[model samples]
Target: MLTRLTPTPPARAPVLPTMGLMLVLPITASGGSLGELKGMSLEELADLQVSIVSKRPERLADSAAAVYVLTEEDIRRSGYTSIPALLRLVPGFSVARMDSAEWAITARGFNGRFANKLLVMIDGRSVYTPLFSGVFWESFDTLLEDIERIEVIRGPGASSWGANAVNGVVNVITKHAGRTEGTLVSGYAGDRERGLAGRQGGAIGETGYLRLYAKHEDRLPQKGLADGSDKDDLSGDRVGFRGDWDLTPADNLSLWGDLFSVDSHDPWIDGSDLMLQWEHARDSGAGDTLRISHDRFEMETATSTDDASIREDLDTFEVEYRHRFAPVRRHDLNLGLGYRWYRSLIEGSEVRAADPAERSFELFSAFVQDEIALVPDRWYLTLGTKLEHNDFTGFEIQPSLRARWNPRPDSTLWAAISRAARTPSRGEYDLVGVSTVVAASPDTQWMPLIARFTGEDRMNSERLIAYELGYRWRPAPVLGIDLALFHNDYDQLRTLEYSDLRLELDPSPRWILSVTPDNLLKGRTYGLDLVVDWRPGASWRLQAWYSLMGMDLNPVSGSTDPEGVALAGRYPRQQAGLRVGVDPRHDLELDLYLRFVDQLPDFDVDAYGELDARLAWRLDPRLTLALVGRNLLSPSHLEYGVETLGSTPHEIAREILLRVEFTY
Candidate 1:
């Protein structure tokens, strides 16, 4: 249900290489790159290969993880451009847009703009920021056309990815240079948003391919908090290049880089990243890979009156090596070693300052994973462990054990138990935050109080132990069902512990409340996800999904953080969605999506349901036009509040857009 569309291949003819080759080499062809399962029967869809589970291509029915794949067909038919908006397709993802440039996204529970438990990657490059151990969703500008697929693992992936993968891992894989050939141009027009994109690709020598692309977009401000307009106008531009070369029959090399500058607010946001990788695969199912990358970004943050207007410049350098091979008769093993260094420059306004404005840190990690084919084609067991060392936390260990059993050829059951961690951010260890004034209540706010968040050098990592079980079954040739259940226990969560109340005469005559960050919060969350796919006829496809989540958080004996008690209600308890796609004629397509979200009583957000419609007509083999509408159910509604800064709840407005795309 996550991917609503797939190419209607004639007579179920799928293009694929050998299993061994597909697992060892990064093939960019159309076979496994962007294809979905809409057109394929339930039986064929069950065997679709996905790699997010153990970093190797494995059949969907055999994987011991909760996974979702949004393919190229889904992106083109949905008429959604932003990555965060498209993530709504997944029932497990709790996505909320706070403004034109800010979003709160998470899996299961603990949803916030600064949600630190989800790890995100772009073509294997990490996008998680170390400043706060979260992602700035607005900074991602990858064009939807360039993406091959969005693979989402709804549970912990720390054994494959590193820290912050406690909740889930989202990897946005892009189309390799070979698949994006020729020239492409696209233009979009709407009342609230407009954008243009162009790309060109060509052959390099006899065995290499290269592509370059540029994109620009701008949006008018959204509806104001109290029935007026908020001053968050957004505009940005991005340029990127990708090149892949087949050095030899057994070796390949790739180099890619991008530069983006955004003028959303006064300070502007800018970033650049470059990476190089080499891979070699042998006939014996052995492969080796070496990768190196560098990234730089600059941004300014002024979220609240008490929060300082800080300008930050940061740089990251990383080097990694990975090898995969068969160690014994029935054991497949993967080994990896990695090192990363982060350096940053932080400058704050006169009201605030970072403890160490200029600082650098290093991280070292190693991991090993083994897959045992216990019953050849019927049962499998995978065990993995990751050991990492950081400056703040001396050492940490993450481990996972997963098992899958195929009771019948058409039914599979899997279970997993994993331990993952979320490391401390620089702000939690060295930054001194000032919360100037906070309202004790909404009515008659008196008493000037200052809340300062003090950082501690000795901070422990937030930890999680998760238990999950899943079942996948195809009752008929046309219908598929997937259900997953999970329970998570969390420890060492951040809590606000006040030292004492005192009078500070210097900055201003006010009562100073020293609130130090502590790990005195504990909680447990449980959830279930259900997805169903049905295709009655070749031209008609229908999908439905539902999600339920519950949270119970408590502060420890010596902690006094009321916000922790209120945090239990930040996310909805129930959500559901339905999607339909129709292609009555060869040249026309129609798609409809309807989604419902439960109310967040604690945050003052009401329940809302919305609809999205898209109609596309193929004028020619190389050109197409479409009309799209978003949030058609209502004029506007509030999805969430930027509660950290106590800003007015943001209202989302409806829009109608026209899109034109052409290829040459």
Candidate 2:
């Protein structure tokens, strides 16, 4: 069993407006600006609404899963410049810096450069790559101010999000165009970061709004372990626009698009991405929504040696439709259908190449969920299932059941059982690479030997059965605590197996060794997560979290792989974080954060603690200044990596950033 902790209200409450207008409107008593909402009471904040679990708006306290919501206030007060850095605030999430532009992030366990089990989406656009089943975190960016909230689910979300959501899900929802009706300019400069950004928005007509934004940034290189040298510098720019319109009282439509490009050194890389999306919604007793999107991404990379190069072009188109309604008084029903088409063109050096070079696939899925109100909200049962078909995996199914019991108005308990799967990726099917070269066996005379790795066509999907339980309690109006535990059983995991070895007498006399991928690994993982939020008063707030995890992996019958088993438990066994926010004056705010991560024994990484601080001053309603210091506990340190991937690991250094913003 695995466990996850989520901050939820102790009792069922009325759903609030998605814009958070109800929570912010009351703050006008102090000031008429958004900043006044910082003093909202804990009770009011707990009543905030969320929709990640069931795809229907509901009070956070009523949610049954281990969910966490990061509001815009949290993002601004944290003073984090990147989305990956902000994720460190979430409990049960492991975030590590692999290099200047790469991150190793995962939930529960199985942390690595390609954390394939997690699913990530930005405003309905899936960012996970089908080629490698991982995300390129550096390729995505957004104006932090334009973000509404980020909903993170620590446990399996396959019942609602489909395959690849075996570990967790991250949904980043941006603010509606109408909410950003203003002109804003922001700039930042630091030891490693320099950027300028601006956005212009206004009413298109009586019932419509539009916003356009652009940004450019340059990042200094990081230092390597051998010597301090500039090796991973990067520069990038992006432009985007969004529009929203209310065609009628019951109908609304939204359109948005973005284009971006980035250049990097070390293994010189040039990449570009273009995306477009359109969505429509109508309220006819129940809600009906439809969305369509298209995205194109291209990347080219070359090693410093110039002997190796790789180019990839990927294009995707997706469509989704969802409906929510009440078939009866006691049951709420939600159903959705989705389809996606993906095409990829890949070219690489002799060391690594794909069989066909060009490939395409399609995926179709449908999901349905029903929520039953047992005993009039005191007890509830939710059941959901997802069925999907893909070119690789003919058919797959994910199912889940959850039960919630509210014994008291200020306390709740929940339990869930779910099934999820991680389907094979393009790399697991057509990839071919050179493993290594070595001398022939003792039996042979003096002959060089070569080992080659190839993908298996009969590869099957990895499966997971997860069990979870959680409790949320508000001991006092000013304090809240959440605890969760989970256990997961995984099977049919991928592993390398020796296929055959033979003597070749072709052009040159040498021995050939062959290896292929197979489903030969099994594992079990369990963990506990705890979170606490305390609001001592109107002027101060504190948040803390702790997580513990353990994993045991074994090879099935006739299979042996000690290295794979060791790699399964490479993440930290214990992790914790603390954050404090204080308002010293009406115009000044201070924040301090502390984080501790246990050592990664498998990677020979020592445990480390870090401290970060931020101070901000509001010159006026339209102008603000802030200074932030990160990794302040040390001058420089390594957070992740033995460089399994070609690039060398670099140490993260202490740095300070100053930023200013103006709005009209």
Candidate 3:
């Protein structure tokens, strides 16, 4: 029911905080005397490995990238239920709650519900939507206890992950079925949210394992600004199954799927998917993998018109194969090929429609990466590139070069340079005459003004050239520090420009301000992230981090655009956090998390501070109890606002929850 409370990372081992892994304090508790506590040992920290950076496992201390891990121990004590909420614990990530269910998450900069530069995966499956190359955080849910670890890379990952992996990459890896071979039930209820989940797992004849789970959640709405009315309520139900089989000592197979229905506003978002993966390993890490999957999602969303809605359906099919082997001594090589197909259908009220009504698209991609040990284990270099062809863009290329050096057994220094791109979304290539915005027409003496735009066929992909540097040091057994710095140059950013103006008499003489999306925006961003972990003794641990960032975006010479103020103010300039984990008596645990987020001038959202506290007690080996209080510093506060996906902005109320857990 609880983790151990002893042993700190030994000397000569610096804890990698990248929970963006910008920061993570791996403290766990279950009651013990002060004399019996200790931080993680140096040997343990050095042995920790992560797989997101290069698609293969490597020691966190030896990797050539700024990466971090959030182990299962961190999740159980955080008192967070959703993946998005748990992300707040990561050092460099910006996780803003737009409303009760909607969220805006990003790393480094550019935060929005539709932020396109970040790529996220669950069990090696991408959750990015082709509609906008962004994730719908509201619908991205899972059983938190099943997670093994979350690996986060805070910089460009295009080299190995392909297009749209410009800002960062997140991989949520779940535990193997064999590790969860038991019955578990967990449930919680609070003023703002409540949910229940249960799982049953068992073993197959000789070498197979299986698990099945079901869960449901309901969330009440936030109070509106004008009238303080209830809005933004959300609810969802989900069921999933997983099976793993070992056919032989060297061959394995896994199949998994999930079905879900989430409702918000007036319409319900529904989806289902299944994945099959088979692998055969010839030698240590030398192997071949084949994967195939199918996914479908359908939903109806409100249109600009007072009573109209846009109904859309999408189906996707993908297949991929990969091979990893040591081609030459001290050199590790990896190669992969992938193909995907998408079928999309859109229907709308008589007022508007998709340009082509129905469409089908294909995508083909391949990537290769190699790692070379310059000197046995003291220095290393890596190079990789990806080539992709898609319906929106004919072809795109991404490449990266990285190097790492162990200046001393106690310290590591690394650097990298990478090129990446974000291709156009379906709306940027196919939508036409859509009702986008409505405003007051001052020219018409305050009459209604409508804005509509058509997709531009000549639009180009947004691109980035990123440079980064990092260092890690373990000065003593009780202290560890990690730092990262980055600068990014962006080109061909998305822009909406004035195209035409029309006056329509049929709709009572209104003005129409027509526009088209373009690539007339370019800019640069730079930032630094720092994290520190310290353990004074076995029962006391503290973790802290701070981030500083700056953005300068300007319109190119040939574009008619809106003022660029909002563009630059979309993200915060500074963020800092502190977490304390304490186990005063064996079987009792206490955690305190405090944070400060700078203001977003673009949205007129002011800077704010908050706190979350969690207390847990172990009654016996099979049952545990916890009380969690969130946003405790204030009764309510607005986290984010303005012009990204939703119409209403509501203040998030303080919350308190009581949770219970049982296992057999």
Candidate 4:
């Protein structure tokens, strides 16, 4: 298991002798700060906010993509204690807990241990691994409070983000140092879980600010076999710091870094990983910005049945520059260039029966986007492309075009077409020797395939062509709706093929082996997204969304895996969720949320629904109390499916968590 925690010297209380200066802090200005922000009308919010994921400054409601903005208020009101649970609210996204800490999250289809479609980032650092082409959700943990907002784009973003942005993009942004300028301490111990966190932030000078935080938690036990058997336990810790300086009124610089390590055991396996990252941003002349970052991640795992283990390490560096050009009235122009390099190494022990291997690669790209106003305030068109090159694949180009029509102040319609790609992971292009078997002759020995670089060098990138259409409307002060439709065509999918294996005897017999990464399957995916928000009154708020998806592969073709079998993508046809919040009085708040997911194929988990609710009372400005309930429909329900070779289908463990949160 892997966890996030902070490891630093004990926190010391801040000494503030200026009693009259307390009111000068922006943080102490009011109690309804976030609530007041959320109460703003759709039009008000639209004009006050800008999103970066769009590559151009656009109002949340005016953007052409199907996007969702999860604010800090949403996190505070959600009864769920974990980050994964928070993700369930996003339409088209499927999030399930595999164990105490592991999670499986994807968009559209083919979600698994190696979900190769989605792209995730924190600030601007990509979290996808080169070893498996997927993210280890468990290893990505942070102090939820530090998050400013999460921007989720539900369709292809390859034109701007490059390969692996085929399905969706999730960007998590953190608050600036100026927003956190006080001492905060929190500690909690609940049924099966215990944790403590501390933060200290203040101004270093008139123009400089810094914040540091550390946290640790213990995992609880889960029932296995549906018989209350304690089969698994999880735990972890994390620590990090962020700082920023104002070099001038128009120029600013920022630096952020963190270190995390996790270790645990009990379920079917145990594992540990260490992650570190550093990022810098600088503003130059005339609306120009530059960013550079570096990251290192390492993880290892051991199974209960064997002493063998698998180890993986990855290192990556990226640099980006953005220039914004000013022009007459409605004209906006932007240009950007980025470079990324990745290296990975994996080792497997004898018990794992897998191969050991090492691989490294680099990807480079430059992009440009320009926004033109057709009718000052009524129409706009945005166009962009990414010209990229990689070691495994030669030069590649991805382009996108979008047009937005805003006939009225509160309504918009948009359409776009884009291209995206997915490069092969180390597992797809490499192999390793697993075991040794004795026979009558040395030539007759048998060995398992481990992860190793094979000399064949035969692999191609998977590509996608996407089309999207969308509409947004705000007919009244309290009602808003957004809808989007998309279609995708996939090609050059990488599939493994069966090859002959040859063995030889010292005196007479001999055998040969064969393998190939051939083009096997073509896939198509189409879907619809609908989001509705209604604020019936100042005290009551409601939000709901529904997603319908359909995916298919040309299975009539031949086999692609070593078993010579065709595999179909697995995902539910429909997923829906609803959330309601009510402030009965100024001091009392209540929230209810419900999520429904259609059963996913390839796994036996049947369709299920989860209901969660929370009640809170503001005892005073400094203290609050909350009672939370999760999985209220069932004490425990099957949330995920797991399968092993030659074994029966089983469900992941599920239980209830009683959590209490306090802030001062």
lDDT against the true structure, each candidate:
0.81, 0.78, 0.80, 0.67
Q: Which candidate is the best by lDDT?
A: 1
Lowest-lDDT window of 10 residues in candidate 2? 23-32
TM-score against native, each model:
0.92, 0.91, 0.92, 0.85
Select the stronger candidate by TM-score from 2 and 4.
2
* lDDT (tens digit, per residue) of candidate 4 on 601-639: 566677888888888766544434566666678756666
Q: Write the per-residue lDDT of candidate 1 for residues 1-664, one digit (tens) a residue.
A: 0111112222222342343433332211122211232355556667778778887778877889999888777777888878999999986789988778778899988888788889998978899888889888888768788887898999899988879999989999887787777666655878888888778777788778888988888878778687697777789899999998888877888898999998766346899999999888877878888999999999886454534577889999999898898457889899899999999888885456678898899999999999998998789899998889998887889999999998888888999999999999988887786665655443314546778877787778999999999998888878889999999999999876777778777755667888767899999999899999897776788999999999999889989776887788889999999999888787678999999998887888999999999997665444456889999999999998757533455788999988755555
Ranking by lDDT: 1, 3, 2, 4
**Candidate 1 wrongly placed segments (more than 4 Å):** 1-41, 302-307, 438-447, 645-648
lDDT of 2 by residue, 1-664 (tens): 0011111212222342322532221110011243554744667656777777777777677778888888877887888877888898898899998777778887978777777899898886788988768787777678777887889899899999999988888988887777776666666778888777778877776777788988877878778776778567778788888887776666677787888887765333333334444333433357777888888888776565443566778888898888887457889899999999999988886777788899999999999999899877699999999999999978999999988998987777999999999999998898777644776666565666777768777989999999999998889999988898999999998777764568878766687777777889999999999999999887789989999999988888876444668765468999999999998988788999999999988777889999999997776554456888999999987777673343566788898988654455
Model 2 regions lying over 4 Å from their true place: 1-34, 37-40, 266-284, 305-307, 435-451, 498-513, 560-562, 643-646
Error of 2 at 236 (Å): 1.5
